[model samples]
Target: MISLANSAARRSLRTVSQVRTLSSGIDIDVDHYSSGWNIDDIGEFTAKTGKYQIKTFNKISEKGLARFNPEKFEIMGSDWDSTNANAILLRSHKLQESEIDVSVRAIARCGAGTNNVPVARCSELGIPVFNTPGANANAVKELVLCGMLLGSRRIVDGVNHMKDLGAQGLAKERVEKDKSMFGGQEIKGKTLAVIGLGHIGASTARDAAALGMDIVGYDPGLSIDSALKLPNEIDLTDSIASAVANADYISINIPYIKGENGTHGIIGKNVISSFKPNAVLLNFARGELVDSEAMKEFLDNGDGRYVSDFPDDLLWDHKNAVILPHLGASTEEAEDAAAAMAADTISDYLQTGTIVNSVNFPAVSLPARPDGAIRMSVINKNQPGVLASITDVFAKAKLNIVQQINQSRGDVAYNVLDIDPTANHEAISMKDLQKELTMTDGVLSSRVVFGTPGCGYARNIDGQYWV
Candidate 1:
């Protein structure tokens, strides 16, 4: 709950490259060189920690930079270098293979859509990437309403047509005469089909319902909690075809992850063919969710109007398209909320071995250890004997387990353990323990965190503490 707005001007945002290795431990890379906006909550969280180092490029926001006290945390200003960055606090900037250093342990994006992040590659590297899902739900919901309004009224085209009318004598008369040509229908009585009922999708459905729009949603993976939270009037449809076929407008809110039964082009030929003629399609989600070429064909056929938050080369400036610069989660409040959540999530994981919102690994939050205890978090391939190997290593080292929690998702499993590190117990080398786990058959990554909730250093013991 630390506020950075009070002292934003004290820290200037400029392009510079520098490196400062504090403890060769947890060095965080703050995306300052991307010319993207930063949030103060992340800096405030880091500042309060007083344990880690944060490296920044030019993109670091004034408030975010201002909150960093040298005495509390090490802050490095750099020009686009992430070589020594172990953890990354990122926003819109893309995290490609070249930009990622082997030192990176985790990457936390400030917003929900992780399309800007290379999630699959990170998973392969056994690095858990995180996102703030519902933190910006309100922001995206408001924008979806805007999109609905824009589609129903044809405001984008109408405004352009109005601007084209020169300010000559009798221009007002001409506008009045031509106004009816741009007139469109209202959304109150219309049906809106929402796909992928995640946080933003469900929020959009509820808000649109309050505006008198009938909601029809389709999401095979919708959780029971999310389902219960949805408005009662919303009719949950069984299939995408059913949702898209009967609606006057459709919103694609699903993630664009490509895998086994993947959503690479979920809104392609089948969904488009079944849509009601003149149905408006709103996609505030990833651009890849809908196939650009297929969507353009549908738009060119004059069957429906397409509005996208993410515009690609194929659909840019199309007469039937209203393209936005990915503003779904761009509000000031959303930026702060998401950044704060991401910072807090990463801080919790690094300091206390807690995984809350990781995309690759299962969420595991264990109770805080006592005064003197050693904590460890392990991410390994989900297979037999992995946990046994981990515990056996601890047993061999004579480390007493104080408390532990374990969870698994698909192919990966997450383990958090707090051990008694008293002088009377055997002196266990965290490095040797990590090496043992890494050498095990299915083990992917292992980390040992020293200290408790208020202070700790998460280090990879396979090699140097930083790596």
Candidate 2:
């Protein structure tokens, strides 16, 4: 009457495969996608699925695939798009409704634009999330350089003028001639002020250093040691105004954001006016870092020219400006590179379950302990005496804590505790812990990870994690 033996075995294997952490640091999921996604393999993921995906652009709809099956596999690269946003919310909603074990990989996160994927939701679900930082450093660097050159040389404008006006000595020469009317200043000997020199800023600095331009980056967070290593000693400034003042061109590379925005505009009319009148502005970074209204006003006054990859909606009444539709890193090569980084990040995560660049999740990698530790990730409401009470419960169970990492993501607090299950009065598996933790008043949920590729967990401002 009961047909649950072999079917259940097959289902379980399909749902959750047994994974063992090996010496190579690859965490092989028993229920993995396929053998093609090997732990050590990087080029294959790109060579097979990604090349066409990135080149064709929107041909392979990972967004649709994610919507249909939220728990099937990790989404490694979701920077923007309406579909991506919906898919992100869909995944979060699914995770919040039940106890879900998940992994995520997001690269080029928090650089610019506020249309981020559902990062906050991952934290709430206790879903272990990972991201790759500085994966697009080269692309971003080249973008900055290109924007600066385009703005300074007025290449686009000069070309437009040539077409509009007839060329030659009689005609053709005239076209090539009088180009200096819009021809701009040479980049050499001009000073450049860079803001927020992480990976992008550092690369931009090296390129600018080769151009014989004096470099001064403004960031309260940067170290003097990092400044000194950039071929030439980049004069460092602590204040934003100090970086902008007197500089021929100001290139912003800050990862700043505001107003529920991780990467929105930071430069306003005030910041715009701070630079010298003839100074050009280049923003291939995050769009929100520059205020559209201020930019419109600045352009109206002919104070400067602005060149950016920001979308049209990001622009106000602007003139003397070139907007490239937020395509700073939209190159084919950049796509392949980003895809490889993202795929590898997800691949590593699906197996051994490590987080290299987690935006919402904690950065710690909870490796399996040699002493056979059972790790418990407990999510509970933010209030008093919850931790103590939970400790009492564990103490009553005669459990000994090995290593614990606790952090509060907004109102909810998460505790990742590694305990020796043998130290308990009796052995307690994840099922027992889950049931017990769920019944507790403040505990949203508790999970026991076998140290398979888990995100460690992700977080957001929403109250969904409490459910």
- Candidate lDDT scores, in order, read 0.69, 0.54
TM-scores, each model vs. reference? 0.79, 0.67
Residue lDDT tens for model 2, 309-412: 77757353355787886676665655555545554444443333345555654445656644455556666666798888767666766777887766664656
Task: Assess the local accuracy of residue 208 in candidate 2 as a C-alpha lDDT between 0 and 100.
Answer: 94
On a 0 to 100 scale, what is the lDDT of residue 73 in model 1? 44
Number of the predicted model whose lDDT against the real structure is largest: 1
Candidate 1 per-residue lDDT, tens place, 171-223, comes to: 57787788887778899989999998989888889888898999999999999
Every model: Cα RMSD to truth: 10.1, 10.1
Off by over 4 Å in 2: 1-114, 118-130, 162-173, 223-232, 260-265, 313-319, 343-355, 381-384, 391-393, 407-412, 423-429, 451-467
Alpha-carbon error at 96 in model 2, in Å?
13
**Model 1: per-residue Cα lDDT at residue 205:** 90
Off by over 4 Å in 1: 1-50, 56-72, 75-82, 167-170, 423-445, 451-467
At residue 147, give the lDDT of candidate 2.
82
lDDT of 1 at 275: 88
lDDT of model 1, residue 451 = 28
